[model samples]
Every structure is written in C-alpha cells, then in structure tokens.
Target: MTINLTLRQLELFTATMREGSFTQAAEKLRISQPALSTAIRKIEVELGLTLFDRTTRSVQPTPDGRHLFAVAEDLLRDFKVSMQGVAERASGLHGRLTLAVLPSVAASILPRALMQLQRKYPGIDVAIRDVMHERAVAMVADGLADFAVTTRIAETAALAYDEIGADRIHLVCRDDHVLAKGKGALPWSALEGHAYVAMAGSTSVRRLADAVLLQADFALQPRFEVEQIASCIALVSAGLGVTALPALTFSMFASDRLTMRPLTGPTISRQIGFLQLKGRQLSAPAVALAGEIRGAYGKR
Candidate 1:
C-alpha cells in the first residue's frame, strides 16, 4: 500500500516522538496541543501503524514508530541538505570556477580578484592554471577552462574577447645596472648592448618582444631564457640580466633590488581582458569572478 502522509504530518510525528508529550511538542512547534495531536493522528491513520503508546502519565514510541522515526530522521536531514544546496545554487554562491591566466597576470592581478571572489561566493571552489598567454586563450577555447585573463590575439574566431585593461611595456633591471644609471624612460635602442633575459619562444610575451624589436630593426641579444615571469623577474633582480615586460608585472615581482623603467621609441602595450568561448554561456561563478577581475583592473 502507498503511504500518503504529508511532510507536515511527518514533521509533527517526529516532533511528538522526540518530545514524548503532545503539550511539549506543541510548545516546540509553536502550535496548539490539539493541532499537534491531530497531525500525528493523520500520519498514523495514513501509515496504518500505531506510532505511539499513549499513557495518562507518559507517551512513548512503539517498536514500529522507533524504526520509522530512525528512517525519517535521516530522510529529513538529507532533504534539508538538498534544499540548502538548491538555495546556494539559486544564489549564485555555489559550484567550481576554472580559469586560465598568463603567469604574469596570475601573479599580479588574479590573487586579489580571487580573494574578492572568495568573499562574495564562499561556496565556490576556484582552480587557476598559470600558463603562457597563448595557452591561456587556448584553454578557454578548448573548454579546459571557463575563461581566461590574457592578451588579445589575431586568431579568435572561436572565442570572445572583452578588453578590461592595457599594460604598457617596461624594462626591468637591477638598481645599479648600467641601463638603470639614467633617469626617465628608456628607448628600445637603449637595450642594444644589454644582456637580455627573454621569455621562452613559446610565450606571447616573447613573441611580442621579438616583433617589437624586429620592427625597430634591433637584434635580440638573449642571455637567458625562462618560461615563468617570476623566474625572469628573479633573474633580473639578481643583476643577471635585463628584461622587458608589462608595467603591471612589476608590482607582483617587485624588489628593492630591481626597478622598472618605461619603454619608449614606439611605446608598446598589450590589451589584457577576459577570453571565453564564443557561443558558450558562462557559469554564474565564472561571471562573478570576471567581474572581480574587471573591478581590480579598474582600481589600478
């Protein structure tokens, strides 16, 4: 036979069993004692089971009542949990957010944005992949990441780009280095004789640097090659070599031993922004995180 007891009946039944008195259950449920008894009686009638042994002095659960109560307790607990999850999803405060970013941006801007994202959506789990700018865009197109914070590219038919901010290129060198001897901005030609710490050829930064130098008819004198921006900055900080990077990168890897000088003679800058799949709809968490990134950029 199918049981037709309502959730209200089950709740009243459980409350009556727990309190062991109709008067006490009514007090806990903020209802009249007669109403509590009527609800529990409806549950007992629908289930065709005597759920309680009523006495003048005391009320106790029967053997069937004890077994049903155990099962109902777990059922109600799980139901409450499921409803809470639904609420969190409706509020856009649950789920995982995956993002790909250039190593420079991951270091410089992502941390602060993520911290803000966390505060706004504490139920969200964030995963960050710090890769080259090219890979950052590729991951978003390939569905490996929800979105990317990276520079623009010529080939973006499969992706959508939103320009959030632009970062001017700068030269990073040791404080006592010869290039740092002069004040104000330095020209691309000024880097002619310096030992350059270049990013690996696979990186977008390296490509941009090469193209800019080539356009200026300047030869690249590479002294060291590294993949991570942090490594390049560390090498420059140690007075090993000078490197060109976005001015925004300076704040993340800054050191008292190293300082940034603007690059002139056709000053170059890259547009950095959000990259997402062209037709795919972003999840709520990803949209929220994108807002955080944009807000951080606006503050800068």
Candidate 2:
C-alpha cells in the first residue's frame, strides 16, 4: 500500500514526539492544540498504526512512531543540505562552467577573464575547449559546451552571437621585412607579390583574408600554408613568409621578431563574441564568466 505522508505531517509527528506533550508541541509550532491533535490523528490514520500512547497529562511515542521519527529527521536534514547547495549554484557561488573558445582568444583574453572569475567566485570551476572557430560553434550547437568565444563566421538562426568586441585584420611579418619599415595602415594592394604564409583554408582567419584579398582584386599566392596559429607565427618570425592575422591572435607572435600593421583601404575586422544556442538561457556561472570575459576584452 502507498503511504501518502506530507513533509508537514512528518514535521508535526516529529515535533509531538520530541515535546512529549500535545499542548507544548502546538505552542512550539504556533498552532492551536486542537489543530495539532487533529494532524496527529491524520498521520496515524494514514499509516494505520497508533503513533502515541496517551493518557491524562501524559503522552509517549510508540515503538513504530520512534522509528518513523528517526527516518523523518534524517530526511529533513538531508533536504536542508540539498537546498543550500541549490541556492549556492543559483547565485553562481558554486558551480561549473564549460566554454568552447577559439585558440586565439583562449590564449589571450581568456586567461585574464578566468582569473577574474576565480577571484569573484572561488567555488566555481571552469572547463575550456580551445578549438577553431567552426569547431567552437559546433560544440555549443551540439550541447557539448555551455557557450563559445569566437568570431561569427556565418549568419545563422540556430546560433545567437552576442558581440563583445572586434579584432582588426593586420599584416604580420618579421621586423626586418621590407613592409615592416612602412608606417601607418597599409593598403591591401600593397601585399601584391609578397610570399604569403596562409592559414589553412578551413580556418576563419583564412576565409576572412581570402574574402578581403578577392574584394581588393589582389592575387597574392601562399608560399607556405599552416593550420595552427603558432606555426604561422613561427614561419613569419623565421622570415619564411608574411601572414595576415587578426589583432587578437597577434598575442601568439614574438613581438621582438615580428611586427603587425593594420590593413586599410576598406579595413576589415572580425566580430568577436559569445556563441550560444538561440533562445536558450545560460546558467548563472556561465553568465558571470561571460561578464568577466567582456571586461577583460574591453581592457585590451
């Protein structure tokens, strides 16, 4: 048979047992003695067992009632602990956040943001997946990550992009390269015949560069193509060839060996932001971390 016992009933039963007097229990619970007595009767009826042995001026819990009281007390204690944990998580004081971020932002902006998040919410833990832009988007879309920090590669309704900032495209080359001697922003046409170190065709950086070069009616060809940003920086630093990269990714380059100039004559920049499933709300910790990331990027 199913026992339909509410927590309120358990509370009343336990209180009556502890106080050992119906009148005193009612006073402690802030209820009328009659109301408390009626509730006790309901519990006994529900369980089909006599919970108390009572006489004039005396009340005592029966063996069965004592056993139920022990179980109920433990359950109430555990419930209280569970609710406290829930409250902490809701406040973003204790929880885990998972983010899929581009390698560039992951290396540059994310470290400072995570440090800020840790200082503000020490109980929060974070997991980071540093991947390319397309993979970062896929991770968020597939529910493999809470959110993503990357460039908006395409327009789509499935994902909502909240732009935190933008990174301008820059031409990166060794400090001794002929182009490095020029001042101010350089026109896209100026890259004409230089040996280009192109990022892999699959990368967002390559796509942006290709689009800009195509629009400028420039036909520069790659002498070296590399997939990783570090490799591109290494090649450029070694004077193998110059590469175009966004300002944020320039953090990976060795400053003493390389220099970057902003591209002009229709300057190009990529929107950097959070990528998440459209219409879904982020968890409290995710929102807090996103704020930290925005602040870190803004400071840069």
Candidate 3:
C-alpha cells in the first residue's frame, strides 16, 4: 500500500514509543500532550495501523508500532546526516569549483590562488579552463563556469567584473637579442625595423600593445602572426622575432631563455579582473576562491 507519511508524524510516533507515554514525549518534543496525540492519530489513521494502546494512566506500543519504530529511528538518523552534508556544502566545506581563465592568468596567477584554496578548503575539487580573454568571459556569462579571470570586458554588460590586478606590456626577446642589452625600459620606437612575432589582433594583449604603439604613430610590423600568447613566446624564443606581451604571459615560458624589458613611451597595461554574471549569487566555494585570487594578487 502507498501510505503517505510526514516526518513530523514519524518523529512523534518514535518519540512516544521511546518515552512510553504521550505526556513524556510531549515534554521531550516541547509540545502539548494534546497536540502530540493529534499528530500521532493522523499518522495512524492514514496508515490504517494502530500504533499505540492507550489507557488512562499509560501508553504502550502495538506490535506494528514496535516494527515501525525501528524503521523510523533509522530513517531519521540517515536523513539528519544527509541534511548535515548539504549544510556543510552550502557553507563551503565541500563542493566543486570551476573557473575559466585567460591563458596568462591561468599559468601565472591561478596556481598560487588554487594552492591557497586547496589548503583552506580541502574538500573542494577544482576545475580550470585556460582560454582567451573573450572566451573566459563568455564562459561565465553562459553559466559554463562559476567565474573567470581575465582582462576587463568593455561591452559585456551582462557580466560583472572586479578589478584584481594589472600587467604591463613588456618587450620579450631571447636573452642574447640586441634589445636585451639595453639597461633601462625600452621605448616603442626601439621596435622600429624589428621583425615582431604578433598575437592575433582580437586578443586583449595584442590590442593593448597595438594601442600603445599606435599612440606614437607606430604599428607592429609582424613577421610571424599566431593566435596564442604561448605560440608568440615560442616563436620569440626560437629567434624568429621579438614580441610585446603582458608580463603575466612570461609565466608560461618559465624555462625558456627569455628576457622581458618594460615598455615605455605611453606606457600601457591591461586591467585584469574576476568576471561573474551580473545578478547571480556565487556559491560559497566560488566566493572563497575569489578571495584567494585577490589575496594571491596582493602577494604577487
């Protein structure tokens, strides 16, 4: 038979059985005896089972009541444990956290932040996607990721961004390249007549570099154009040409023989930020991860 039952009724039944009297169970549950008896009556009527033998002086459990009491005790115990797990997850004690990040930030900034997150919240499993700036924001806006680390998006009105850091454009070349011999910051004009390994025009890193160079009526004369910062760095390390990129991009080439010189003459930098949907509330783990990222930036 399909018998509809409520947890409150089961709790009352089990308590009455344990205490052996309606007066005692009512006191234990902090309810009036009449109210407890009414709730038990409703459950007994619904199940068509006489769960208790009542008398003027005392109460005793029926045979069926003895069996159901055991079941109810176990069910309530398991239910309480399940609810505790849910509560813990809601408070950031356990869960999954996913982030979409720009390639540079993924390589440079996120590692430290993730380490901090793991130490503080060990029960959280992390997933990260290294992508271009535009795609990172797109992932947040599409709900494919909990948050993103990327350059500030100018036209993404549906996404909210909080500035976390900024990375200056640097002229990166092989250590033995002639430009690396200079002592101070390199001027944009120094790039004149130099073969440049450029990133795709759509990238925020390329856009920032080009904007600063254009202020001096200069444009990157590309000898090799690639889509990713890693590719640009690879070409530069191979002595194909020099490239201008954010200092954060240097993290990916940690073992490469590269020298980065700060660029001047209308100095430029890209503002990095955390992006999330404008109106959505982040889960506890995501908020914790965001705080860790900000802390990592401060430390860096």
User: Cα RMSD (Å) per model?
Assistant: 3.6, 3.9, 4.0
lDDT of 1: 0.85
TM-score of each: 0.79, 0.76, 0.76
Q: Show model 3 residue runs off by greater than 4 Å.
A: 1-73
lDDT value, candidate 2, whole model: 0.90
Looking at model 1, the pairs that clash are none
Tell me which residue pairs clash in candidate 2.
none
- Compared with the true structure, what per-residue lDDT tens digits does model 2 show for residues 15-92? 988998999999999999999999999999999999899899799889998998999999888888999999989999
Candidate 1, residue 80: CA error in Å?
A: 0.4
Local distance difference test, each candidate? 0.85, 0.90, 0.87
**Compared to the true structure, candidate 3 yields what TM-score?**
0.76
Q: After superposition, how far is residue 48 of candidate 3 from its true place, in Å?
A: 11
> What's model 1's lDDT at 297?
83
Model 1, TM vs. native: 0.79
Regions more than 4 Å wrong, model 2: 17-24, 48-62, 81-99, 113-127, 137-147, 176-194, 253-256, 277-292
